[model samples]
Target: MEDAAMEDGETNKDSEVAPALIAVHPTQNSVAVAVGSDLRVFDLLGGCAVSLVNDSDGSLHKDSIRAIRYGANGKLSVSAGDDKLVKIWSTKSWRCISSVEVIESLLTLLAVKR
Candidate 1:
């Protein structure tokens, strides 16, 4: 049955890809978008793309980013997704300051902090 499903190009729920997500800065100066494993930002003031700096050795998110949020004060941003990693960013510098792996058991705690 599994082989037949594969041959028919049927995809399981777990294998389904997520839709792109968009987040606007609190001050409405910029907007960030997550498409697949790529992250893009646009400057509302300049009417151009904002180049982001990732100090890490690899891409921001290894998998699709499911959520992107900005702090109420417009000073910080967060991104998390299927890669099982959460990242904190500095909105001023547009740089990633920290990243942590997500543990299934601690998911509740993380959500509560958000």
Candidate 2:
């Protein structure tokens, strides 16, 4: 099957190519991209890359990330993947706050203001 990265305009020309899973911050001009096993954040306007969270210390996901989104407050971000788990992360500390499992593949995540 074709990878989602290819659909996102990324090409795999190398042996070590990794799929890209990206999420844009709600209020900031920044974006988060999960390439291979690493999560990278970049500035949209400055064109400079920013590093938000690195799960290199341990495995971030059992498989590739399928979706990511900014929370309602813009202080948190959410990620869901083939692992069948949804992770909540803090924007300030870049730390995982919670993880919840769900049935079937997680297709999307939407943040609602309360």
Candidate 3:
């Protein structure tokens, strides 16, 4: 989940800010989570919350990640953030496959494969 400060008139309110928590897809073998400024993908079936992927290279997003969802093929996962960008990663290799800018602060992203 992503955390953002609410703009209150002229000042930004930080005290009332709340971080977002993203849930993984129920049928996916992996789970994606955004904690603080890092994006982590976990191996759900392994019992231990093992880290399978990480996006902390400063190129992904400066702020927290807002949303994460598995693609229709179950082999890809998409993530969007306040950075106004959407990134798609492969579940098998846990590598970035594509990225697109939507020009708006993306609240969520869903990838469908035909």
Candidate 4:
């Protein structure tokens, strides 16, 4: 399958690639996307407008994002991928807060609170 992946060490660019997976923020009405080796988010506050993320550095992920999910009533978003890492981001800034490495391929994931 063809995937539109950005060049190495590259961050945001035109989304020419088809997304591998998608998750909706339950209360935020936003969407999280797993596109190629990147994870992008679109905040639907008004229309379908979106902006590039991880603009500060090309540190979003090293491989294609495999899964994404929202939890805590849309306050937090989680993403995982072939990189064997699960990243958690805050909804307020869309900034990554933590990273946890695993030993398995992250083909699917979920984030929830008890």
Clashes of each: 0, 0, 1, 0
Each model's C-alpha lDDT?
0.77, 0.69, 0.65, 0.72
Name the candidate that leads on lDDT.
1
What's model 4's lDDT at 36? Answer: 78
lDDT accuracy of residue 22 in candidate 4: 79
89: Cα error in model 2, Å: 0.4
Error of 4 at 40 (Å): 0.9
User: Candidates sorted by lDDT, descending order?
Assistant: 1, 4, 2, 3
TM-score of each: 0.80, 0.61, 0.66, 0.69
lDDT for each residue of candidate 1 in 1-114, tens digit (9 for 90 to 100): 989888567556557676778888878689999887788888989999877787875688887787788888878888887778888888888899988888642221122133
Q: How far is candidate 2 from the true structure (C-alpha RMSD, Å)?
A: 7.9
TM-score of 2: 0.61
Can you write out model 3's per-residue Cα lDDT over 42-76, one digit (the tens) per residue? 67678555434445443655656777777666777
The collision pairs in model 3 are 1-20
- Model 4 / residue 28 / CA error / Å: 1.7
Candidate 2 C-alpha lDDT tens digits along 49-107: 75455354355667557777787667988777767777777888777777778797644
Candidate 3's displacement at residue 28, Å, is 4.2
